[model samples]
Target chain A: MRAPDLIRFARDAAAGNPLRTVLLVLAMSIGVASVVVLTALGDGARRYVVNEFSSLGTNLVIVLPGKSQTGGFNPGNAITNTPRDLTIDDAQALLRASAVRRVAPLAVGTSEISVGGKLREVMVAGTTAQYIDVRRLPLAQGRFLAEGDWRRGASEAVIGAKIRDELFGANPALGQLVRIGDRRFRIIGIMASTGQGLGMNTDELVLVPVSLAQAMFNSNTLFRVLVEANSRESIELAKSQATAILKARHEGEEDVTVITQDAVLATFDRLLGTLTLAVAGIAAISLAVAGILVMNVMLVSVTQRTSEIGLLKALGATGGTIRTAFLTEAAMLSLAGAVLGFLLGHAGAAIIRQLYPVYPAYPPDWAAIAGLGTALVTGILFGVLPARRAARLDPVESLAKR
Target chain B: MMNEPLIALSGVERVFQLGDSEVHALHQLDLRIDSGEYVAVMGPSGSGKSTLLNLLGLLDRPNAGTYRLEGRDVTTLSPEEQARVRSERIGFVFQSFHLVPRLTAAENIALPMVLAGTAPSERRKRVDQALKDYGLTNRAGHRPNELSGGQRQRVAIARATIMQPAVILADEPTGNLDRATGEEVMRLLEELNGKGVTLIVVTHDAALGARAQRQLRMEDGELRQDSRQCAPRT
Candidate 1:
């Protein structure tokens, strides 16, 4: 038969039974929609983490004072204690590496800050003037600490946006004296509001010079070191150079961990990428269930339409033609369902994007195409049994039924 | 000189197995039908008249037979080859009219031509002519349920002859209609036969059988009598 005629026949047959067709299409569409929406969520999480890390700094490397016993760096290792202290001398030694552009030695401690009869416990981060440039932090008011002697402590502090708001309210806080722990320092700068990074809210921090913070905390050990590579291509070179320098400074012991920004992003990327594939596989089970539903409904249709099959055969339709006609009907229903599912999944993803607003919950292109392709293939594969049965039916017996 | 037969069958046997017991539906049947002949097969129930009609229509395969159509050994042809021959040379009309209830009258009439892959324009032309010839022009868009009994029968006949087959096999063609509608349907079949299309009608109605130019009576899965009559002018 002509292709148009065959399609018309299949369409009419499907249209003849509205409820069955709708139910079949609904099942298939639900299967496809679940695959798309779930994968969107999985991939969305991966992208969110990657964006968060990229915002910290590009071509950046972090140095923690502890040796991570595990080979790879885990985020949890940031809190572990080390066998040796990483001081300002270790931070300065990293600059000798050809690939290392700058280094900021960080001494973090919690202290009570009292300003104009207002006292609040805040996180204190101590580093050099280069800390601003290396961490890509912006200042909201006044100037940061000047480049001065690393050994002689400076009595100057930079308050975070939240501290300035809380302590000084609407009044100017720059050039005001704030007492931190047992010492008083003049507030030289106020930092812009950076919601949160790593585990600390930068908006709630108080920045001081490294030597002063080390004195206030009664320790000469540094908590972390932030390193910036000269170029993107030099990140790996900078990481190894810092490791070698730190090992030499710590008496031939590699007592500190250096991790590149790319390594962390890649770990999260691979972890979440696998998770997306796993969820997609689970969602594909629904398609198989939908395939079974198609097979069951088609079997019933074959039984119900036996006389029609017989009539077509009596009109000189071959077995292959009958099979093709039934399969065409299946493909049409599946394709319609897949299109409906595509729209529904995109709408669902859009809703998620709107709800979170931070993450772009768009399903991957390959996932959408694979969902549709699998739906079609599964529909046709399941259609074979019923179609073959229809083709093999005895025309004499089938026509007698009517 | 004798004209070559359009259909010939010899030593035809059809057996149906019912739980290890074989029942012979047709046994040692021999028959020949020429083009343009109007033949009626008449028998009581269980005498296998329907079975014989099905075999002649190629809807069923005989277990042992040498069946030839247009000098071709159709009994040995593959299933696909048989379907091609059926589409090109054979047509069937059933007792129930068997009009696809979902389709319009025009689509029903064009079904055979569509199966034969006839060009759409030619199919349209032929369907239009069939509708006009069957006196169903006004009802071309109506479905089977919307049509009257005689109209449905006319549509079935139109569909059967749409491919312009050499033979038309109809089994109890008017079984569901009133006597007047049945007579009208039979007249239509006779008119087609008069135009040189071979027509075979299977019926238990002796009066209807008498109207055909040739009649075969069956009993006990065997042909009991074959009779020929002169053409009756209506």
Candidate 2:
């Protein structure tokens, strides 16, 4: 038979049994939609994490003071017990590396800042004048701390947007003296309002000179050392150089962990990439279930239409033709279900995006194609047994039944 | 009529195993049917009339036989080749007027041509003409359930002749209809035979069997008589 006629025959058969067709299509489409939506969610999480990490800075490396023996670093390790301290000397020493562009030594501590008798506890991040450029932080008002001797302990602070808004309100707060941790410091800059990122709300932080924070806190151990590479190619070189310099400064003991930003991003990238595949695999199992459903339904349909098959055979249709006709029916159902599932998955993803606009919950092209392709292949593969059965039916026996 | 026989069967034996004991459906039967002959095969139930029809229609294979169609040894042909021959050279009308319930009369009539891969335009033209020839043009769009018994049988006749086959094999062509409708259907079959197309009708009704130009009577899986001549039964 011609291709169009075969398709028409299959279509008419499906139309004849609308309930069966709907159930089969529903099973197939649900399987495909789950794959699409689940993969989209997995991939979306990966993208969100990657974006968050990239937002830290480009070609950046982070140096944590304590060496984690397990080689796994967590944000809580910043304040953990350490055998040695990474101070301003180590930060200054890193500038000697040719690949290193700038270094910012960070000292983190909680302090009560009182302005006009109004006191609020805030997270204080202390760093040098170069910290502004290294962290890619923008200033909303006034200049950042002036470049000066690292040991002199300059009394200057750059408060976050939220801190400034709360402390100063409508008044101009730059150049105003605020008492932080029993020390007076002039507000030299106000940071632009950047929302929460990587577990830190930058808008609520108060930046101060590292020398002053170390003196006020009565400690010389630095919390973190943020380093910038000269270029993208220099990131690895910078990491190794920073690690060597820190080890050398700490009596040849590798007491700190120096990790490039790309390494962290790559780790999360691989982790989430695997997660997407795993979910897709789990979702593919449903396709197999749907395929089995197709087989069962088609087997029943063959039994119900035995007489019709006999009529076709009596009308001179070959076994091959009958097989092709039934298979065509299967393929049509799966193709239609796949297309509907594709649209449904996108709609589901769109709903997720609408609920959480921060994440782009878009399904990858490969996932969509794989889901549809697997559905088609699975439907056709499972259809073989039933089609073969229909083809092998004894026409005489089939006709005799009627 | 052509000199060469259109259908020739020799020592055709068909056996069926019903659990243990074997039933010989067609016992060493030999028959010859010429082109354009109107023949009736009359036999009681269990007399192997249907088995003989099935073998002649290529719907069943004989356990032992040599059957020839148009002077070609069809018994040695593959199932696919036999199906091709059946599509090209034979037609069938069932006692129940086996029209596909989902299809209209027109689509039912066009089914054989569709199976034969005829062009859509040609199939359409021929179906239209067949509908007109069978007086079914007004009922072309009606499904089998909506049509009267006579109309349904007319549609079946239209479908049977749409392929323009050399022979039409019908099993109890009027068994499900009243006498008036039965006569109408028999007249249609006779008209096709009159057009030089061979017609074979299998019926248990003596009246219907007597209407054919030649009569074949079977008993106990064997041919018992040929009314065309006082010839010895094979």
Q: How far is candidate 1 from the true structure (C-alpha RMSD, Å)?
A: 4.3
lDDT of 2 by residue, B25-83 (tens): 89999999998788999999999999998888998999998888988888888878888
Backbone clashes per model, in order? Answer: 0, 0
Candidate 1 is graded, for docking, as medium
Worst 10 residues of 1 chain A by lDDT: A73-82
Error of 1 at A183 (Å): 5.7
What is candidate 2's DockQ? Answer: 0.72
Which TM-score does chain B of candidate 2 obtain?
Answer: 0.96
Error of 1 at B46 (Å): 2.0
Give residue A370's lDDT in candidate 2 (0 to 100). 99
TM-score of the second chain in each model? 0.96, 0.96
| Local lDDT at A167 for model 2 | 90
Per-residue accuracy of model 1 over B64-93 as CA lDDT, tens digit each: 988888877888888788888888888898
